[model samples]
Target: MSTSTISLDHVVAWLARFRELVTEQQSYLTELDSAIGDADHGANMVRGMNAVVEKVGAAPATAADELLKSVGMTLVTSVGGAAGPLYGTLFLRMGVSAGPVAELDGAAFGAALRAGLDGVVARGKAEAGDKTMFDAINPALDAWDAAVAGGADIAAAASAALAAAEKGRDSTEPLVARKGRASYLGERSTGHLDPGATSSTLLFQALADTVTS
Candidate 1:
């Protein structure tokens, strides 16, 4: 479908999915986080996403960019720890790149997501192998770009992206921490999965499921 056909409903649906997924995986996320970081990533994310859902439900935004920006701001204000600012900035940049639109096509959405990743990089200064969210998000965006270049539909492209993200998240388990709180642990962080990578993977999975279903 065309980008213009992606209504505000799509954005709302994606947010809902984000809340649901994070809530469902809260314990797992927290467990993973506790190993390397402060152990509040999952709980913090759930709290932030729930607040986002409430905000969206109370006064639904008409524009896609506005809705995303609202989500980003809510996360920034509600969630604690480094995740709050990192993820918050990601969405804020996404909103800016998306502009005040009602809809977006696969290519436009991909570009907006890439912009978000750029923001994450700028804010965190973490590279792909740093065992951060970039590990998952970077590969996911790359896969999406590849899928789009291959003339895949949005749903197909999103699916590919999610798969790549999941793989990236999984791959972080054996990595030595190189950024953020986990890096403080040095070699001690080698066996644990990165909480940020896990959450980032969930975010893309939610987006893929929401738009396709």
Candidate 2:
């Protein structure tokens, strides 16, 4: 089962693993959000992820774009609030970057991931140190690019990305919110670990699990 590229099957597995992780962390996510947000981060992701799996898992995608597009559209429609649009934009941009391929080599995957990260930034208008998902996502992209450039396999690169994501997520704990609903809390946002950052970390973890599993 040795492979150098991420095939459609791998993408599907990534989505499935992500769904499982989000569902498992739903309550924890909500609890994290309760301190700073509307308290729906967990449920929104779970609902969106479930729909993504139901759609993408139901049938094997003939092309990578097909599956990714389905996932993006589903997330945008099913999930509520900013999470839906931001997450959906990620998949949509990934789909666009993936083209019609059935598999993605390490470099191709990196490019697609970078595109997805850029899309989130464009849609969210947030950056690192903003105490938002960008904190995790930006670092994950840097780690992914570096890992792949260093000649790591997709699995190894994914693991690196996840580790970076975790570090980014943790780094959010002490920062005061500069964006989103949490911004209104001002100084009060400093102590709480950002829920968006936490969930974004899960996204990379799911990618690593799918590649290694």
Q: Give the best candidate by lDDT.
A: 2
List all candidate RMSDs to the true structure: 1.6, 1.0
Estimate, for each residue in 1-213, the C-alpha lDDT of model 1 and write its tens digit: 323235678878888898999999999999998999989999999999999899989997888789889888988999988888998998899899999888887788889889999998999999978999999999999999898889888778888999999999999999999998889999999988899999999998997887688
The lDDT values for all models are: 0.89, 0.90
lDDT of 1 at 65: 85
**What C-alpha root-mean-square deviation, in Å, does candidate 2 show against the real structure?**
1.0
Residue 6, model 1, lDDT: 52
Deviation in Å, model 2, residue 171 alpha carbon:
0.4
TM-score of every candidate relative to the true structure: 0.96, 0.97
